[model samples]
Target: MLEKVYPPFIFNEFDRKNKFGLFMDVEKVIYSGVTKFQRIDIFETKAFGKVFTLDGVPMTCELDEFVYHEMISHVPLFLHENPKKVLVIGGGDGGTVREVLKHPSIEKVIMCELDEEVVEATKKYLPNLSYELNNPKVHLVFEDGSKFIKNFNNEFDVIIIDSTDPTEGGGGALYTESFYQDCFKALTENGVFTAQTEEPFIEKEWMIRAYKRISSVFNVAKLYLGFVPEYTPGTWSWTFASKNIDPIKDFNPEKVRNFDKELKYYNEEMHVASFALPNFVKKMIKDI
Candidate 1:
C-alpha cells in the first residue's frame, strides 16, 4: 500500500483552513472496478433490490434484467409462426433462454456466452435470472458470438443478441456491420433477430448508423424502446431485423405458456406501445 506523510510546512498550511472538519467513519466497499468491468449488487430498495450499482453506476442485477431478457426473447418468438430453433448471443445470465423456453413451439435454444465468469457470477448472485441454465432444451456455448454466427447457415428462427454496450471491448463486434451480416446469415427465411441497442437519448448517432446497416441487409429493420431503469437515461432501445417478417404484424402472445406471473415491465399493451416511438425519435430515423 502507498502512503504519504505530511511535512510540518504542509500540515501548518492545511490547518489554516477554517472549513476543514474532522474525518468521519468510512464504510465498507462492496464492489469496485474500471469500465471494462465492475461489480454490482442486486438487492437495493430504490431499484427494487433487483439490480445494483457499483462505483455509482448500475452494471447488472435482477430487478431490471427480466425486462430486457423477456422482451428480446419473447417478442420474436411470439411473432414467429413456428419458432422451433433459437440462438442467443452474449446472454450469459441465461435470462433470455429462460424466457424462450416458456414458448411451446421452441424445441432447442442455443446460447453463446463469451465469459463463463458472467454465467457463474449471475448464477451465484442472481439465481432468479440464471435458473434455466441447465434446462434440457438449452445448450450453452462458451465462444465468441459474432464468429459463431458466421458458421451458422440460416438454421434459426430467431437470434437474440443480449449483449452489453459495445463500448466494452468484448461486446464491440456485436455493433458492427459485419456482425449484422453474420446474423443475417444465421437466420432462416422469415427469421427475426433482436438486440439491445444503446440508450436512445445518449446514442442517437450510433443508433441511426446501426439501423441503416441492418436495413441494408434485411427487408425490414425496426427500432423499439423498453424501459429498464438500471441502464442510463432510464429507458433503453432494442433493434430488430427480419428476413421477411414485419415485427409489428408478427406479434402473437397467446402462445406463451408456463407464465412465471412475475413480470414487471412487459405486457400485451406494453408490447404494442413499445413500437410507438415519440415524434423526435421518428424524426431521427426518418431522415436516415
Candidate 2:
C-alpha cells in the first residue's frame, strides 16, 4: 500500500519593490481560486485559524479580525450623534457590516462590494465575520465603490470604507482623492467618515498621503492607531474625518460604554486615547 501525502502550503506576502514582507507556514490549503478582480485564497495556519487573502495579502483571519473591523466601523459611527444610514465600501467579507449593525441607531447599510466572489467565499468559510450579511438592514450591492458613491447626494449619514490595500484587486480606485471628495458629497449634514490607512512604519508615506488627501476634502481629518497582532510593524492606522464634528471634543465616551453589543477591541477609553499619537507619528503627519 502507498502512503498518502498531504500537499504543502505556504503563505507569502512580498513588497513589490523591496521584497520585504511576511512569510508564514500554512497548515492546509482549504481553498484557492482566481476571481474576475483578483486571486482569492483561504487556508489554515497554526497561529491564525482560517485566513483569507487577496493576491497574497492577508485580508482577515479567525484571530484578531475584530480589532480592524471594530476600529474602522465604530469610530466613525460613534463620532456621529445619530448615524442612521451608512455606506460601507469594499469589505466584501462582511466584517465591517457586522460591526456597523451593532449600533441600534443604524437603520440601513449599503455595502458596495467590488467582487461578489469575495462575499460568497467569506460567507461559506468565515461565517463569524460574514454572517451579519443576512441582516435585513444590510443591502449588498455589486459595483465599484468609488463609482457607486458618486451617484448619491447628501444620502448617507456615515460612510465607512473597509478597503483592501490599494495595490491589490480593485482597491486602487478607492484610494484616490476624488473618491474622498465623492464620499464627502454623499454624506448628509454632520456626517462622519473613516477608513483603514496603512501601517505607519512600512507604509508611512502612503499613510501620510492618505491623510493629506482626506484632509483636503473633509472639514476635519485625524489619524488614529490600533494594534493588530497579525499585521507587520504591529501598529495600524485609521483616518477619521468629519464635517463640523470633532472626534476629540464631540466624542462622548459614555456612548461607547452604553453600546448594547459586546465589542472585543473598541471601548470607552479607546475612543479618545487612540487619537493620541506617538511623537514620531505626530511629527510625520502633523503640519499637513
Candidate 3:
C-alpha cells in the first residue's frame, strides 16, 4: 500500500494496484507508472470526483488545468494591443507558457520556475499539455520569481503568475504584498499582471486578502472565475491587478481570433461575464 498525506485531508490506505482509501475525507485512485518520476494521485469522489496528481502519476480524479491556464494567460495578453514581452511565474509545467505563446504578437516569453524537477516531470509525463516549451520565444529560468522581478525594470507588457495554491511550500511567497509591488515595478506603464487566486469556496478569505494587497499596489484590480477540478472543491478563482489599463476595454475579439484558433472558453462576451461574480462572493470581497 502507498501512503501519502495531503492538507485538509488524509490518505490512509492503498490497494495493491491503483485504489486508495481516505480517512473519512474522500476516496482516491492512484496511477503508478514511470515517465520521469514515481507519483501518486488523489481524487475526491464527492466533488466532481476530481483528480489531483503528484510527481508523475495520474491520481484517482482529474482536473482540467487547461481552462484556468488559458483564461489567466490569454485575458491579459489578448487585452494588450501588441504584447511583445511576457513573464510567467511558477508555471513549471509549461501550460501557461504554451498559451502565452499562442499570440503571434508576442516576441519573447520568460518563464521563472522555482523547481526544475517539476518542469522535468511535467515535460516527461504531460507532454501534450506542455508542448509549448519547445517554442523559440520561451526562456525558462529556474530561480525565485520574486527576486527576478525586483531587478527587472519596466520590462514586460504582461505578467502572469500561474502558481500552485499558497499553502504549498515554496509557493507561499507568491501571495505576499512585496511580490505584487515587484510585479508593479516590473511592468511597463500600461502593463498588466494576473495570478491564480484560490478556490472561492475554500480559500475565500485568503483570496480577498491577496486582492486587497494587490489593490494597494496597482491601480486596477479584478477577480474572475473558471472551473478547474484538480484544486479543492471544484471552482477556481483568478485575480488580476494592473498598473494602468482597463482589461476589458482593451480587448477586441476579432484581433485575438486572428492570433489563435484553439481557444474554447474566452471570447469577448465571456471576458466581461467572468468578472460578474455571484452575490455571495461579491459580498465576501466587496471591501477589497
Of the two candidates 2 and 3, the one with more favorable lDDT, higher being better, is 2
TM-scores of all candidate predictions against the true structure: 0.80, 0.93, 0.80
Better of 2 and 3 by TM-score: 2
Q: Provide the global lDDT of candidate 3 against the true structure.
A: 0.71
lDDT of 1 by residue, 219-284 (tens): 888888887765655677888889888877777655443345555667776777888999888898
lDDT of 3 by residue, 1-288 (tens): 235444345443222222532232445443333333334343454543444455422222324666777889888887777789999998877778878887888899999987776677567656656688878898999888878888798999999987755643333788898999999989999788899887576546677877777888899998888766554455778888787777677667787656545876777777778888998889888865
**Backbone clashes in each candidate structure, one number apiece?**
3, 0, 3
**How far off is residue 138 in model 1, in Å?**
1.3
Candidate 1, position 208, lDDT? 76
Greater TM-score among 1 and 2 belongs to 2
Residue 275 of model 1, lDDT score: 89
Residue-level lDDT of model 2, residues 3-61, one tens digit each, is 11223444354443446655456788788878898888887888778788887778888
Candidate lDDT (C-alpha), each: 0.70, 0.85, 0.71
